[model samples]
Target: MGAMVYWVILSLSILALGVWVFWSVRGVRAYVRARGKRLVTCPETHCAAAVELDAKGASWKAFRGGNYFRLQDCSRWPERQDCAQDCLQEIETLGQGCLVRTIVAGWYSGKTCVYCRKPLDKVEEWTGHMPALLDPDQKTVMWGEVPPEKLPGVFENYKPVCWSCHIAETFRRVHPELVTDRPPRW
Candidate 1:
Protein backbone atom coordinates (compact mmCIF):
# COMPACT_ATOMS: atom_id res chain seq x y z
CA MET A 1 0.00 0.00 0.00
CA GLY A 2 2.83 2.39 0.96
CA ALA A 3 4.64 1.63 -2.30
CA MET A 4 1.50 2.42 -4.29
CA VAL A 5 1.14 5.74 -2.40
CA TYR A 6 4.80 6.66 -3.18
CA TRP A 7 4.30 5.90 -6.86
CA VAL A 8 1.23 8.10 -7.05
CA ILE A 9 3.05 10.97 -5.37
CA LEU A 10 5.98 10.60 -7.73
CA SER A 11 3.65 10.68 -10.72
CA LEU A 12 1.95 13.84 -9.49
CA SER A 13 5.30 15.52 -8.89
CA ILE A 14 6.49 14.68 -12.40
CA LEU A 15 3.26 15.96 -13.90
CA ALA A 16 3.51 19.23 -11.98
CA LEU A 17 7.12 19.66 -13.09
CA GLY A 18 6.13 19.11 -16.70
CA VAL A 19 3.40 21.71 -16.47
CA TRP A 20 5.80 24.23 -14.95
CA VAL A 21 8.38 23.63 -17.63
CA PHE A 22 5.82 24.10 -20.38
CA TRP A 23 4.73 27.46 -19.04
CA SER A 24 8.34 28.57 -18.55
CA VAL A 25 9.31 27.73 -22.10
CA ARG A 26 6.29 29.48 -23.53
CA GLY A 27 7.05 32.56 -21.45
CA VAL A 28 10.68 32.63 -22.58
CA ARG A 29 9.69 32.36 -26.22
CA ALA A 30 7.29 35.24 -25.77
CA TYR A 31 10.09 37.31 -24.29
CA VAL A 32 12.64 36.55 -26.99
CA ARG A 33 10.19 37.17 -29.83
CA ALA A 34 9.23 40.54 -28.39
CA ARG A 35 12.80 41.71 -28.00
CA GLY A 36 14.00 44.03 -30.81
CA LYS A 37 13.97 47.60 -32.04
CA ARG A 38 10.43 48.55 -33.01
CA LEU A 39 9.08 51.45 -34.98
CA VAL A 40 5.77 53.03 -34.01
CA THR A 41 3.88 56.25 -34.47
CA CYS A 42 3.57 58.25 -31.29
CA PRO A 43 -0.05 59.01 -30.62
CA GLU A 44 0.54 62.34 -28.90
CA THR A 45 3.17 63.76 -31.24
CA HIS A 46 1.90 61.92 -34.33
CA CYS A 47 5.53 61.24 -35.30
CA ALA A 48 7.45 58.04 -35.76
CA ALA A 49 9.43 56.78 -32.80
CA ALA A 50 11.90 53.95 -32.28
CA VAL A 51 11.06 51.92 -29.20
CA GLU A 52 12.22 48.81 -27.40
CA LEU A 53 9.82 46.75 -25.32
CA ASP A 54 10.30 45.72 -21.70
CA ALA A 55 10.95 42.12 -22.60
CA LYS A 56 11.83 40.92 -19.11
CA GLY A 57 8.71 42.44 -17.69
CA ALA A 58 6.61 40.90 -20.40
CA SER A 59 8.20 37.50 -19.84
CA TRP A 60 7.39 37.54 -16.16
CA LYS A 61 3.86 38.56 -16.89
CA ALA A 62 3.54 35.79 -19.42
CA PHE A 63 3.51 33.28 -16.57
CA ARG A 64 0.29 34.93 -15.44
CA GLY A 65 -1.27 34.23 -18.87
CA GLY A 66 -0.81 37.63 -20.54
CA ASN A 67 2.19 39.71 -21.56
CA TYR A 68 2.58 43.13 -19.93
CA PHE A 69 4.25 45.27 -22.51
CA ARG A 70 5.84 48.59 -21.69
CA LEU A 71 8.48 50.69 -23.34
CA GLN A 72 11.99 49.89 -22.27
CA ASP A 73 13.49 52.67 -24.38
CA CYS A 74 12.36 55.16 -26.99
CA SER A 75 13.90 57.64 -29.42
CA ARG A 76 11.76 60.47 -28.06
CA TRP A 77 12.67 59.84 -24.44
CA PRO A 78 13.76 62.28 -21.71
CA GLU A 79 11.41 64.85 -23.23
CA ARG A 80 8.11 63.07 -23.91
CA GLN A 81 8.33 59.79 -22.05
CA ASP A 82 5.58 60.61 -19.62
CA CYS A 83 2.93 60.38 -22.27
CA ALA A 84 0.66 57.35 -22.16
CA GLN A 85 2.09 54.42 -24.12
CA ASP A 86 -0.71 54.29 -26.64
CA CYS A 87 1.88 53.07 -29.13
CA LEU A 88 1.97 49.61 -27.57
CA GLN A 89 -1.35 49.00 -29.22
CA GLU A 90 0.46 49.06 -32.53
CA ILE A 91 2.90 46.41 -31.33
CA GLU A 92 0.08 44.33 -29.94
CA THR A 93 -1.70 44.56 -33.27
CA LEU A 94 1.26 44.10 -35.61
CA GLY A 95 3.31 41.60 -33.61
CA GLN A 96 6.60 40.90 -35.54
CA GLY A 97 5.80 43.24 -38.41
CA CYS A 98 6.98 46.32 -36.50
CA LEU A 99 10.38 44.81 -35.77
CA VAL A 100 13.26 46.55 -37.53
CA ARG A 101 14.72 43.19 -38.43
CA THR A 102 11.55 42.20 -40.22
CA ILE A 103 11.31 45.55 -42.00
CA VAL A 104 14.94 45.49 -43.14
CA ALA A 105 14.70 41.88 -44.24
CA GLY A 106 11.66 42.70 -46.32
CA TRP A 107 13.50 45.62 -47.90
CA TYR A 108 16.47 43.42 -48.83
CA SER A 109 14.33 40.66 -50.25
CA GLY A 110 14.65 40.10 -54.04
CA LYS A 111 17.19 42.92 -54.22
CA THR A 112 20.78 42.74 -55.39
CA CYS A 113 23.72 44.59 -53.91
CA VAL A 114 24.21 47.92 -55.67
CA TYR A 115 28.02 47.48 -55.66
CA CYS A 116 28.71 43.84 -56.64
CA ARG A 117 25.25 43.14 -58.08
CA LYS A 118 25.19 39.92 -56.05
CA PRO A 119 21.90 38.81 -54.50
CA LEU A 120 21.63 40.10 -50.93
CA ASP A 121 20.58 37.30 -48.63
CA LYS A 122 19.04 37.37 -45.20
CA VAL A 123 21.16 39.06 -42.52
CA GLU A 124 23.05 36.35 -40.70
CA GLU A 125 24.55 37.21 -37.35
CA TRP A 126 26.30 33.82 -37.06
CA THR A 127 28.34 34.55 -40.22
CA GLY A 128 29.40 37.98 -38.90
CA HIS A 129 28.67 39.49 -42.33
CA MET A 130 25.99 42.16 -42.27
CA PRO A 131 25.08 44.16 -45.36
CA ALA A 132 25.23 47.96 -45.56
CA LEU A 133 23.52 50.81 -47.34
CA LEU A 134 24.95 53.41 -49.67
CA ASP A 135 23.71 56.89 -48.99
CA PRO A 136 22.73 59.42 -51.66
CA ASP A 137 26.24 60.94 -51.53
CA GLN A 138 27.78 57.46 -52.19
CA LYS A 139 29.03 56.90 -48.64
CA THR A 140 28.65 53.40 -47.17
CA VAL A 141 27.17 52.93 -43.69
CA MET A 142 25.60 50.27 -41.50
CA TRP A 143 21.95 50.39 -40.54
CA GLY A 144 22.78 50.89 -36.87
CA GLU A 145 24.64 54.09 -37.76
CA VAL A 146 21.36 55.69 -38.74
CA PRO A 147 18.87 56.87 -36.16
CA PRO A 148 15.83 54.64 -35.90
CA GLU A 149 13.43 57.54 -36.26
CA LYS A 150 14.94 58.40 -39.64
CA LEU A 151 14.97 54.83 -40.94
CA PRO A 152 11.86 55.30 -43.07
CA GLY A 153 13.38 58.17 -44.97
CA VAL A 154 16.79 56.53 -45.13
CA PHE A 155 15.32 53.33 -46.50
CA GLU A 156 13.63 55.28 -49.24
CA ASN A 157 16.74 57.25 -50.21
CA TYR A 158 19.58 54.72 -49.70
CA LYS A 159 20.77 51.84 -51.83
CA PRO A 160 21.74 48.40 -50.53
CA VAL A 161 25.36 47.10 -50.63
CA CYS A 162 26.57 43.60 -49.87
CA TRP A 163 28.96 42.93 -47.02
CA SER A 164 32.01 42.37 -49.21
CA CYS A 165 31.48 45.51 -51.29
CA HIS A 166 30.78 47.57 -48.22
CA ILE A 167 34.14 46.65 -46.74
CA ALA A 168 35.95 47.23 -50.01
CA GLU A 169 34.29 50.57 -50.62
CA THR A 170 34.98 51.76 -47.08
CA PHE A 171 38.63 50.74 -47.35
CA ARG A 172 39.03 52.43 -50.73
CA ARG A 173 37.34 55.57 -49.51
CA VAL A 174 39.46 55.75 -46.39
CA HIS A 175 42.73 55.01 -48.18
CA PRO A 176 42.22 56.32 -51.69
CA GLU A 177 46.00 56.65 -52.32
CA LEU A 178 46.59 52.93 -51.67
CA VAL A 179 43.63 51.82 -53.81
CA THR A 180 44.48 52.15 -57.48
CA ASP A 181 41.77 52.05 -60.10
CA ARG A 182 41.81 48.84 -62.14
CA PRO A 183 40.47 48.63 -65.68
CA PRO A 184 37.79 46.05 -66.43
CA ARG A 185 39.60 42.84 -67.33
CA TRP A 186 36.43 41.46 -68.95
Candidate 2:
Protein backbone atom coordinates (compact mmCIF):
# COMPACT_ATOMS: atom_id res chain seq x y z
CA MET A 1 0.00 0.00 0.00
CA GLY A 2 2.83 2.41 0.87
CA ALA A 3 4.58 1.69 -2.43
CA MET A 4 1.37 2.34 -4.42
CA VAL A 5 0.82 5.70 -2.68
CA TYR A 6 4.38 6.84 -3.53
CA TRP A 7 3.96 5.95 -7.23
CA VAL A 8 0.70 7.95 -7.46
CA ILE A 9 2.33 11.04 -5.92
CA LEU A 10 5.28 10.83 -8.33
CA SER A 11 2.95 10.57 -11.37
CA LEU A 12 0.99 13.66 -10.31
CA SER A 13 4.17 15.72 -9.92
CA ILE A 14 5.44 14.65 -13.37
CA LEU A 15 2.12 15.58 -14.99
CA ALA A 16 2.18 19.04 -13.41
CA LEU A 17 5.75 19.65 -14.61
CA GLY A 18 4.84 18.59 -18.14
CA VAL A 19 1.90 21.03 -18.19
CA TRP A 20 4.10 23.89 -17.07
CA VAL A 21 6.66 23.20 -19.77
CA PHE A 22 4.02 23.15 -22.49
CA TRP A 23 2.57 26.50 -21.40
CA SER A 24 6.00 28.08 -21.20
CA VAL A 25 6.89 27.03 -24.73
CA ARG A 26 3.59 28.32 -26.04
CA GLY A 27 4.10 31.74 -24.47
CA VAL A 28 7.65 32.08 -25.84
CA ARG A 29 6.49 31.29 -29.37
CA ALA A 30 3.76 33.92 -29.13
CA TYR A 31 6.21 36.58 -28.06
CA VAL A 32 8.54 35.88 -30.98
CA ARG A 33 5.80 35.93 -33.64
CA ALA A 34 4.34 39.19 -32.35
CA ARG A 35 7.64 40.98 -32.00
CA GLY A 36 8.23 43.78 -34.54
CA LYS A 37 8.01 47.56 -35.13
CA ARG A 38 4.84 49.28 -33.85
CA LEU A 39 3.36 52.73 -33.01
CA VAL A 40 0.92 53.79 -30.28
CA THR A 41 -0.58 56.87 -28.60
CA CYS A 42 -0.24 57.43 -24.83
CA PRO A 43 -4.03 56.82 -24.41
CA GLU A 44 -4.30 60.10 -22.50
CA THR A 45 -4.90 61.96 -25.86
CA HIS A 46 -2.48 64.88 -25.54
CA CYS A 47 1.12 64.34 -24.49
CA ALA A 48 4.60 63.58 -25.68
CA ALA A 49 5.86 60.14 -26.62
CA ALA A 50 5.78 57.28 -29.13
CA VAL A 51 5.92 54.02 -27.19
CA GLU A 52 6.89 50.63 -28.69
CA LEU A 53 6.10 47.37 -26.92
CA ASP A 54 6.56 43.57 -27.00
CA ALA A 55 3.39 41.81 -25.99
CA LYS A 56 1.75 38.42 -25.37
CA GLY A 57 -1.99 38.52 -25.96
CA ALA A 58 -4.60 39.03 -28.68
CA SER A 59 -3.48 41.57 -31.29
CA TRP A 60 -5.44 44.78 -31.96
CA LYS A 61 -5.78 47.64 -34.46
CA ALA A 62 -5.34 51.26 -33.41
CA PHE A 63 -8.23 53.51 -32.56
CA ARG A 64 -9.34 55.71 -35.46
CA GLY A 65 -8.79 59.17 -34.09
CA GLY A 66 -10.33 62.04 -36.07
CA ASN A 67 -6.97 63.72 -36.53
CA TYR A 68 -3.28 63.45 -35.78
CA PHE A 69 -3.59 66.17 -33.16
CA ARG A 70 -5.92 63.88 -31.23
CA LEU A 71 -3.48 61.01 -31.39
CA GLN A 72 -0.49 63.13 -30.34
CA ASP A 73 -0.05 66.67 -29.14
CA CYS A 74 1.66 68.70 -31.86
CA SER A 75 2.13 71.71 -29.61
CA ARG A 76 5.44 70.23 -28.44
CA TRP A 77 7.00 71.89 -31.46
CA PRO A 78 6.44 75.62 -31.31
CA GLU A 79 9.31 77.16 -33.20
CA ARG A 80 8.32 75.71 -36.59
CA GLN A 81 4.72 75.01 -35.57
CA ASP A 82 5.35 71.70 -37.30
CA CYS A 83 5.28 68.46 -35.38
CA ALA A 84 8.28 66.80 -36.99
CA GLN A 85 8.85 63.90 -34.65
CA ASP A 86 7.20 62.22 -31.70
CA CYS A 87 9.51 61.20 -28.91
CA LEU A 88 10.14 57.43 -29.25
CA GLN A 89 10.89 54.65 -26.72
CA GLU A 90 10.27 50.92 -26.28
CA ILE A 91 8.47 48.98 -23.55
CA GLU A 92 7.47 45.36 -23.04
CA THR A 93 3.68 45.12 -23.11
CA LEU A 94 2.08 42.91 -20.51
CA GLY A 95 -0.98 40.73 -21.28
CA GLN A 96 -1.86 43.09 -24.18
CA GLY A 97 -0.22 44.74 -27.16
CA CYS A 98 -0.35 48.53 -27.62
CA LEU A 99 0.48 49.35 -31.23
CA VAL A 100 -0.66 50.82 -34.53
CA ARG A 101 0.88 50.12 -37.90
CA THR A 102 2.87 53.07 -39.21
CA ILE A 103 3.19 53.91 -42.94
CA VAL A 104 6.94 53.16 -42.52
CA ALA A 105 8.10 56.33 -44.25
CA GLY A 106 8.21 59.38 -42.04
CA TRP A 107 8.84 59.69 -38.30
CA TYR A 108 5.11 59.39 -37.69
CA SER A 109 4.11 57.59 -40.86
CA GLY A 110 3.47 60.73 -42.91
CA LYS A 111 0.32 61.43 -40.98
CA THR A 112 0.87 65.14 -40.28
CA CYS A 113 2.71 67.80 -42.20
CA VAL A 114 5.98 68.88 -40.62
CA TYR A 115 5.49 72.45 -41.77
CA CYS A 116 1.86 73.58 -41.68
CA ARG A 117 -0.65 72.08 -39.29
CA LYS A 118 -2.47 70.35 -42.15
CA PRO A 119 -3.75 66.88 -42.92
CA LEU A 120 -1.26 64.68 -44.77
CA ASP A 121 -3.87 63.43 -47.23
CA LYS A 122 -4.40 66.90 -48.64
CA VAL A 123 -0.71 67.73 -48.94
CA GLU A 124 1.99 65.69 -50.60
CA GLU A 125 4.36 64.09 -48.08
CA TRP A 126 8.07 64.54 -48.69
CA THR A 127 10.79 62.59 -46.93
CA GLY A 128 13.33 65.28 -46.10
CA HIS A 129 16.74 64.05 -45.01
CA MET A 130 18.90 66.11 -42.67
CA PRO A 131 22.23 67.06 -44.14
CA ALA A 132 25.32 65.87 -42.22
CA LEU A 133 25.31 69.03 -40.10
CA LEU A 134 22.39 70.17 -37.97
CA ASP A 135 22.60 73.59 -39.52
CA PRO A 136 24.19 72.97 -42.89
CA ASP A 137 25.99 75.91 -44.45
CA GLN A 138 24.01 77.88 -47.00
CA LYS A 139 26.18 76.45 -49.77
CA THR A 140 25.46 72.83 -48.80
CA VAL A 141 21.73 73.48 -48.55
CA MET A 142 21.67 75.39 -51.79
CA TRP A 143 24.42 74.14 -54.07
CA GLY A 144 25.71 70.85 -52.67
CA GLU A 145 23.71 67.66 -52.86
CA VAL A 146 25.28 65.22 -50.44
CA PRO A 147 25.73 61.74 -51.97
CA PRO A 148 23.68 58.78 -50.67
CA GLU A 149 26.68 57.45 -48.73
CA LYS A 150 26.87 60.68 -46.79
CA LEU A 151 23.16 60.87 -46.12
CA PRO A 152 21.76 59.63 -42.78
CA GLY A 153 20.38 56.08 -42.60
CA VAL A 154 16.66 55.42 -43.10
CA PHE A 155 14.43 56.66 -40.28
CA GLU A 156 17.35 58.71 -39.00
CA ASN A 157 17.75 62.46 -39.25
CA TYR A 158 14.54 62.84 -41.26
CA LYS A 159 11.18 64.59 -41.20
CA PRO A 160 7.93 64.60 -43.17
CA VAL A 161 7.41 67.92 -44.90
CA CYS A 162 4.50 68.93 -47.09
CA TRP A 163 5.05 69.54 -50.81
CA SER A 164 4.79 73.32 -50.58
CA CYS A 165 7.12 73.59 -47.63
CA HIS A 166 9.42 70.97 -49.10
CA ILE A 167 9.76 72.81 -52.37
CA ALA A 168 10.27 76.07 -50.53
CA GLU A 169 12.82 74.62 -48.15
CA THR A 170 14.61 72.60 -50.81
CA PHE A 171 15.25 75.72 -52.79
CA ARG A 172 16.22 77.54 -49.63
CA ARG A 173 18.82 74.85 -48.90
CA VAL A 174 19.95 73.92 -52.40
CA HIS A 175 19.77 77.34 -54.05
CA PRO A 176 19.66 79.83 -51.25
CA GLU A 177 20.76 82.63 -53.55
CA LEU A 178 17.80 82.25 -55.92
CA VAL A 179 15.10 83.21 -53.39
CA THR A 180 16.78 85.04 -50.51
CA ASP A 181 16.93 88.47 -52.11
CA ARG A 182 13.42 88.28 -53.58
CA PRO A 183 10.75 89.47 -51.19
CA PRO A 184 7.53 87.41 -50.85
CA ARG A 185 4.73 88.79 -53.10
CA TRP A 186 2.34 89.72 -50.29
Candidate 3:
Protein backbone atom coordinates (compact mmCIF):
# COMPACT_ATOMS: atom_id res chain seq x y z
CA MET A 1 0.00 0.00 0.00
CA GLY A 2 2.83 2.49 0.81
CA ALA A 3 4.53 1.65 -2.54
CA MET A 4 1.36 2.45 -4.42
CA VAL A 5 0.93 5.72 -2.55
CA TYR A 6 4.50 6.73 -3.44
CA TRP A 7 3.95 5.95 -7.08
CA VAL A 8 0.77 8.00 -7.18
CA ILE A 9 2.56 10.99 -5.63
CA LEU A 10 5.31 10.78 -8.20
CA SER A 11 2.79 10.64 -10.99
CA LEU A 12 0.95 13.66 -9.64
CA SER A 13 4.18 15.64 -9.41
CA ILE A 14 5.05 14.79 -12.98
CA LEU A 15 1.62 15.82 -14.19
CA ALA A 16 1.81 19.11 -12.31
CA LEU A 17 5.22 19.85 -13.80
CA GLY A 18 3.95 19.15 -17.30
CA VAL A 19 0.97 21.40 -16.79
CA TRP A 20 3.18 24.21 -15.47
CA VAL A 21 5.54 23.98 -18.40
CA PHE A 22 2.74 23.95 -20.94
CA TRP A 23 1.13 27.04 -19.48
CA SER A 24 4.44 28.86 -19.27
CA VAL A 25 5.19 28.21 -22.91
CA ARG A 26 1.73 29.26 -24.06
CA GLY A 27 1.87 32.42 -21.97
CA VAL A 28 5.20 33.41 -23.47
CA ARG A 29 3.92 32.77 -26.97
CA ALA A 30 0.88 34.91 -26.36
CA TYR A 31 2.98 37.71 -24.91
CA VAL A 32 5.31 37.68 -27.90
CA ARG A 33 2.40 37.89 -30.30
CA ALA A 34 0.62 40.60 -28.38
CA ARG A 35 2.92 43.44 -29.33
CA GLY A 36 4.57 44.93 -32.43
CA LYS A 37 3.60 47.29 -35.23
CA ARG A 38 5.55 48.51 -38.22
CA LEU A 39 4.90 51.96 -39.53
CA VAL A 40 4.81 51.93 -43.32
CA THR A 41 4.24 54.65 -45.86
CA CYS A 42 2.52 53.94 -49.15
CA PRO A 43 4.36 55.61 -52.02
CA GLU A 44 1.81 55.03 -54.72
CA THR A 45 1.35 58.17 -56.73
CA HIS A 46 -2.39 57.83 -56.67
CA CYS A 47 -2.78 56.69 -53.09
CA ALA A 48 -0.12 57.93 -50.74
CA ALA A 49 -0.83 56.90 -47.18
CA ALA A 50 0.74 55.67 -43.97
CA VAL A 51 -0.47 52.58 -42.17
CA GLU A 52 0.75 50.75 -39.12
CA LEU A 53 1.30 47.07 -39.84
CA ASP A 54 0.79 44.23 -37.40
CA ALA A 55 4.21 42.83 -36.65
CA LYS A 56 2.86 39.37 -35.93
CA GLY A 57 1.28 39.16 -39.38
CA ALA A 58 3.09 37.94 -42.49
CA SER A 59 2.37 41.23 -44.23
CA TRP A 60 4.36 43.05 -41.57
CA LYS A 61 7.28 40.73 -42.13
CA ALA A 62 7.45 41.59 -45.81
CA PHE A 63 6.80 45.25 -45.12
CA ARG A 64 9.40 45.64 -42.43
CA GLY A 65 11.84 43.20 -44.00
CA GLY A 66 13.00 45.83 -46.45
CA ASN A 67 10.15 48.26 -45.99
CA TYR A 68 8.55 46.74 -49.09
CA PHE A 69 11.63 45.37 -50.75
CA ARG A 70 10.41 41.79 -50.89
CA LEU A 71 6.78 42.09 -49.80
CA GLN A 72 4.61 44.49 -51.72
CA ASP A 73 1.35 44.39 -49.81
CA CYS A 74 2.72 46.53 -47.01
CA SER A 75 1.72 50.00 -45.97
CA ARG A 76 4.67 51.50 -47.81
CA TRP A 77 3.42 50.44 -51.23
CA PRO A 78 0.48 48.13 -50.99
CA GLU A 79 -0.07 48.28 -54.73
CA ARG A 80 2.93 45.99 -55.20
CA GLN A 81 1.05 43.19 -53.45
CA ASP A 82 1.16 41.00 -56.54
CA CYS A 83 4.95 41.02 -56.92
CA ALA A 84 6.79 37.72 -56.64
CA GLN A 85 9.25 39.20 -54.17
CA ASP A 86 6.53 40.10 -51.71
CA CYS A 87 5.87 36.61 -50.43
CA LEU A 88 9.25 35.03 -51.19
CA GLN A 89 11.30 37.50 -49.15
CA GLU A 90 12.23 36.57 -45.63
CA ILE A 91 10.42 38.41 -42.88
CA GLU A 92 12.39 40.75 -40.63
CA THR A 93 10.87 40.41 -37.21
CA LEU A 94 10.86 43.68 -35.31
CA GLY A 95 12.77 44.13 -32.09
CA GLN A 96 14.60 46.83 -30.17
CA GLY A 97 16.70 47.76 -33.19
CA CYS A 98 13.68 48.67 -35.29
CA LEU A 99 11.89 50.39 -32.45
CA VAL A 100 14.75 52.61 -31.28
CA ARG A 101 15.56 53.75 -34.80
CA THR A 102 12.00 54.78 -35.55
CA ILE A 103 11.85 56.59 -32.24
CA VAL A 104 15.08 58.39 -33.07
CA ALA A 105 13.72 59.43 -36.45
CA GLY A 106 10.82 61.11 -34.71
CA TRP A 107 13.00 62.76 -32.07
CA TYR A 108 15.63 63.86 -34.57
CA SER A 109 15.18 64.93 -38.15
CA GLY A 110 12.83 63.34 -40.67
CA LYS A 111 12.42 66.23 -43.07
CA THR A 112 15.74 65.96 -44.91
CA CYS A 113 18.25 63.48 -46.21
CA VAL A 114 21.19 63.01 -43.87
CA TYR A 115 23.60 62.03 -46.65
CA CYS A 116 22.73 64.59 -49.34
CA ARG A 117 21.37 67.19 -46.91
CA LYS A 118 18.47 67.89 -49.26
CA PRO A 119 14.87 68.47 -48.33
CA LEU A 120 12.92 65.25 -48.70
CA ASP A 121 9.99 66.08 -50.90
CA LYS A 122 7.83 63.19 -49.81
CA VAL A 123 5.73 63.27 -52.93
CA GLU A 124 8.72 62.95 -55.21
CA GLU A 125 11.53 61.65 -53.02
CA TRP A 126 11.70 58.20 -51.56
CA THR A 127 13.62 57.67 -48.34
CA GLY A 128 15.43 54.87 -46.57
CA HIS A 129 17.57 54.21 -43.51
CA MET A 130 21.16 53.11 -43.08
CA PRO A 131 22.41 52.42 -39.59
CA ALA A 132 25.19 54.75 -38.52
CA LEU A 133 28.63 53.20 -38.56
CA LEU A 134 29.99 53.08 -35.04
CA ASP A 135 33.57 52.58 -36.18
CA PRO A 136 34.64 54.90 -38.97
CA ASP A 137 37.24 52.34 -40.03
CA GLN A 138 34.69 49.55 -40.22
CA LYS A 139 34.21 50.44 -43.96
CA THR A 140 30.51 49.61 -43.97
CA VAL A 141 27.35 49.60 -41.93
CA MET A 142 25.20 46.49 -41.71
CA TRP A 143 22.03 47.41 -39.86
CA GLY A 144 21.18 43.80 -39.19
CA GLU A 145 24.52 43.25 -37.52
CA VAL A 146 24.02 46.15 -35.14
CA PRO A 147 23.55 44.70 -31.71
CA PRO A 148 20.15 45.46 -30.21
CA GLU A 149 21.60 46.15 -26.77
CA LYS A 150 23.66 49.02 -28.19
CA LEU A 151 20.73 50.70 -29.94
CA PRO A 152 19.52 52.51 -26.83
CA GLY A 153 22.81 54.35 -26.53
CA VAL A 154 23.06 55.32 -30.20
CA PHE A 155 19.65 56.63 -31.03
CA GLU A 156 21.26 59.61 -32.77
CA ASN A 157 23.36 57.33 -34.92
CA TYR A 158 20.56 56.23 -37.23
CA LYS A 159 20.67 58.25 -40.43
CA PRO A 160 17.82 59.08 -42.74
CA VAL A 161 18.92 58.49 -46.30
CA CYS A 162 17.02 59.32 -49.42
CA TRP A 163 16.60 56.51 -51.93
CA SER A 164 19.18 57.94 -54.34
CA CYS A 165 21.88 58.25 -51.71
CA HIS A 166 20.91 54.97 -50.08
CA ILE A 167 21.56 53.19 -53.39
CA ALA A 168 24.90 54.90 -53.87
CA GLU A 169 26.04 54.48 -50.28
CA THR A 170 24.99 50.85 -50.14
CA PHE A 171 26.84 50.13 -53.38
CA ARG A 172 29.88 52.10 -52.31
CA ARG A 173 30.06 50.33 -48.99
CA VAL A 174 29.55 46.93 -50.58
CA HIS A 175 31.81 47.57 -53.57
CA PRO A 176 34.21 50.37 -52.76
CA GLU A 177 36.22 50.01 -55.97
CA LEU A 178 33.15 50.62 -58.15
CA VAL A 179 32.50 54.16 -56.97
CA THR A 180 35.40 56.48 -57.54
CA ASP A 181 33.90 59.94 -57.27
CA ARG A 182 31.62 60.68 -54.35
CA PRO A 183 28.30 62.40 -54.83
CA PRO A 184 28.74 66.17 -54.52
CA ARG A 185 26.87 66.12 -51.22
CA TRP A 186 29.02 63.41 -49.77
Best by TM-score: 1
Clashes of each: 0, 5, 4
**Sort order, lDDT high to low:** 1, 3, 2
Best candidate per lDDT, number?
Answer: 1
| C-alpha RMSD by candidate, in order | 2.1, 15.4, 16.8
> Over the stretch 111-131, how does candidate 3's per-residue lDDT look in tens digits?
565677765444322134443
Once superposed on the true structure, which residue ranges of model 3 sit more than 4 Å away at CA?
1-33, 37-102, 119-135, 138-142, 156-160, 182-186
Tens digit of per-residue lDDT, candidate 1, span 1-186: 999999999999999999999889978987997799998888887888999999988888886588687998999987877878899999899889999878888888888899789888665641587788999999999887988888889878999998889999999999998998889897
Worst 10 residues of 1 by lDDT: 121-130
Candidate 1 segments exceeding 4 Å error: 121-127
Compared to the true structure, candidate 1 yields what TM-score?
Answer: 0.89
- Each model's TM-score? 0.89, 0.28, 0.33
lDDT of 2 by residue, 44-89 (tens): 4433233333233412221111111112222222442344333332
Report lDDT (CA) for all predictions.
0.87, 0.40, 0.45
Instruction: Report the lDDT of model 1 for residue 29.
Output: 85
Query: For model 3, what is the error of residue 158's alpha carbon versus the real structure, in angstroms, after optimal superposition?
Result: 5.7
